[model samples]
Target: MKILLIILFFVNASTVNAKTFSVTNLANSATSEDCLDYCVDGVCFWLVCGWGCSVKTTPHINHNLPDFVVSSYNEPGENSFSEVQSLDVMKNIQGGNLTTNSKSKRANSGLKFKEASVTGNPVAYAMGQAKYLCNSKIKPYMPYYLSTLDEKMWRSGLSDMLYLSTWVPGMNEVSSNKNQTDEFLKSWGSLYPRSGFLNQKNEVKTASVIAARALEVVSDGGARIYQSSGCTSADCMKKNGKWQMISPVEENSCRAFGIESVEELKDKVDEDGQYGWTAWRNYGCCIPGPGAFIGSSITGCLN
Candidate 1:
């Protein structure tokens, strides 16, 4: 009986101390806080700077691609914020497209899939049908690929929010993948217009509006909103000197944005017992889009 008790104790302890994987490499961290700080650095560099600097790397910036893939297997729940399931989804779906094609593979919009069947009434058929359904569900989560560009279809201007949130040492054009970035901008034209946003030249500032809008499109209802690094709830104030948070109360990220109090934002708890506010707001993918300036959590109507 004592031996059995000892075995049970070890089993319980192991279960209690199990660690979950993070997309960011934080294995060298000294404490949980230090680990989280490292993840945040990745956020500031790869995510924040990424919007203005590169298009190819943008999809991999955060939990967007991975979490969406995971949600295909199971409905996204409260604790969905912390998980990264990209690799598993890729392995299950398409031999893990081990090269550049993974993100761009689905770029062709007209691709089609075979229908799943379970007519044989066997366990294998059931499993196949289930996998098919999951694949089907991920269809809408796919990101858009720019079709082409027309010089006739361009607009030029910048939002105050975009000006503040985009990369520093700004230039008329910048990106790691210059060819792709220029093509993307040419397809979408200039940044969506806004009043009173300007660059040093006193012209409308141009930021990564296309990519920003894409983030909104893919995340639609799946993620939380956040304040960009230099800005906060205070920056979301209206002309009349009052803050108006347009996102739903449950989805609000900070107190300044019409949430009754910070407590409301902090009240929600994920399945992991992490506060809902922290879970949503702190996740790298949940960064606010340009529309956060206009009191909305998403990039508003683009047309």
Candidate 2:
């Protein structure tokens, strides 16, 4: 009896202390083929007119850097990444009890609510080390946004309702489910409210929906632009940033929201109701020339 009790105690403790995502694992997730989409897009010239023009090749690099690690889970203090577990303490004090009740309600109804946290990826610098690849704008382990702290905006859903896209169909949708013949283009959920509540049925889909919303919030506001020549528009989805699945199932590929289908991701659901993703932004760089800025030409490179 004594031996059995000791074994059970160790097993339970291991389960409680287990971490699904960590710096080491996430750093290993980086793959050369998917993360580094390096290509020479165009050429820049510094024309001296009388003197011969100095031409420099400009490369349009697609770096799948782990800008942020977004975690969406049922438990308030339970984060998949071991580093940001400390942030959960604030979550518990704020509205952890409310989240507990919401979890039970989610199981009963199709409506689901998940608390999400966005933190700087610990392995961002390591992943984005290519010569001309874009530098990460966010620092490792920096807590950008915590859903529990933004109760009025994230929980109430009032601010998001004001947007016309929220009411009108096909406005700011994450993806279109209508005529998506491609399996990787299926819709997961809406992008409005930028909140925790979602009407998704699948557990994996719910976690992804929350993660997407959190990414939209942070990219649009917190870490605006990582690339030097990237778009400066309010919509981060437009040629500014992309997402790479990092946890539960890590993918070497990186793509825009609608490009990657949620249907393919259904099977990779984490049993603990935890999910993670890395935000990848585009960057355009050119080798320096000894002359002033003049003009550049494009080679039809698709960013």
Candidate 3:
């Protein structure tokens, strides 16, 4: 009892200094060629996990388009530090309520989800979604499973999001929606297996990653964004290029141009929203190429 108490006291003392935050199990250096194996049909694992993630995560680079799910589409590039993901905001949804209801198309200016735990399909994004904690308030957030897709898209989003923490950026501290959550998990699990896919429609060979995700909430669907050990093919950059960094969008603009932190780039309503990263190098390296120019004037799009 005495030793146990001593250990507990030290542990508590350390907790007072720093808080533990949960993050996805993805590594830092991810590449594009990683998609070659998973691209398929029905299996939807490709669609469910990889391809779908690609579309939602990458809206600015649509060299190719898919038939179903998400279409490959890249918003025109910008000269700012941040690259915004702005869509046409579809004047209307073809058959769904987006056009009929009028409310979903612009509900809460599309900033809120009325507790999917109660109101959405137990599958899809409605699953793995969560409510987070920021400061003294709690708010909605996608879980690490879903947010894994977020990690793949932007470098510092997880951290930026945690920092901006419009609300505490942690998950489901408490939720009465377990039944729905389980149902949703079952559906998701059927699609994504512990190692290989259980569903015959898909057959995935885990190369360097323990997990994967297709960003559905962002980009309306286009490419698959996932976190893995690194590049798979020798010709990695051949398809997906590295995230290049730039600086100071304008000489004196408050929002410097470059790669906007995920949150800023994700929710921003500008052409070049990628240029607004809150951290220059707080967490890690900013990046190179796309937005890096030590001291060059506006020669073109980024830096």
Candidate 4:
């Protein structure tokens, strides 16, 4: 696929404050993070410079291009947040793009979820049908082409998770990819702090969204089990299990992923074994319904 990647780098010069050096590309390589060097005493030492900004090589920052929002989408972008007065009503599809249950329900679940997103047997056929003609916006990446036909199908199926979660305001529960890309922007428009991409809300949403879709797409919901990197995975396993938590022992990484209550779920266990403790809110994806527990638990943890 023609995926866009923005790159950034830093160069060394005389270290007087505000001394502007051109910071020209010293090495002739497409990979910006490779070493191009001198040394402490003009001898060659090894420097590894990539997104992590290791010493010895110049720092390189990378960003994805053809940002999703710019593409033509079925849903309308947020227009009147203040005048709408109700987020619930704002998302209503009576005249437009929602269901009555869409307000209370986290998302379409069970077999209905299949039709709620996209449909088809051939992968390319479905992706091509992604309804740019419904509203019709213009972008280079609209019909994003990839090498494998399966990849095209995967992208098509994943479009539901990516498009809906991103385009819809309710789904964008935290600082999104747009915000992430901005915070990371260099002079050439690469994000400054590479770490910003890791704990990013968009990253979590997209990753989880893609994961959810990937599960469904690859296995047609037969492979219900998914392995996630953060809170979502932890919470999924937490629900429906005996769940002997180790307790919040100053979990720094949990907080970093927007997990506000790592400490609370620590001691929390189902004495009655009926109510599974917060599997949704504690998980990576924000289940933005009236109750926070919408996305996490499944069927009351009996098993």
Name the best candidate (by lDDT). Answer: 2
What lDDT tens digits, residue by residue, belong to model 3 across residues 1-303?
A: 532333233334322111111111000101112211112111111112344332111111111100001111111221111111122122222111111122333322321110000001111111112111001111112121122223232222232233222133222111112354543332212111111111211101010011111111221212323222122322222111121111211111122122233354333222211121110100101112222233222222221
Better model by lDDT: candidate 3 vs candidate 4: 4
Q: TM-score of model 2 relative to the true fold?
A: 0.73
Q: What is the lDDT, from 0 to 100, of the residue 4 in candidate 2?
A: 33
The ten-residue window of minimal lDDT in model 1 covers: 112-121
**Poorest 10 consecutive residues by lDDT, candidate 4:** 64-73
lDDT of 1 at 230: 25
Worst 10 residues of 2 by lDDT: 222-231
Total residue pair clashes for candidate 4: 10
Misplaced by over 4 Å in model 4 are 1-61, 66-141, 145-303
Better of 2 and 3 by TM-score: 2
Cα lDDT tens digits for candidate 2, 141-233:
877767766666776667666666567555556663444333223556677767778776667667766877776667554322221212233
**What lDDT tens digits, residue by residue, belong to model 4 across residues 1-303?**
110111122123222121111111110111221111111211112334457533232111111111111000112222111111121122223111221133335223221111111111111112122221011111211211111223223223333343443344433232223444442331111111110011222212222222223222222221122222222322322211111111111111211112323354424221111110001111111112221221232222111
What is model 4's C-alpha RMSD? 23.7
Minimum summed lDDT over a 10-residue window in model 3 is located at: 21-30
Task: Give the better candidate number (1 or 2) by TM-score.
Answer: 2
Candidate 3 regions exceeding 4 Å error are: 1-107, 110-275, 280-303
RMSD of 1: 23.6
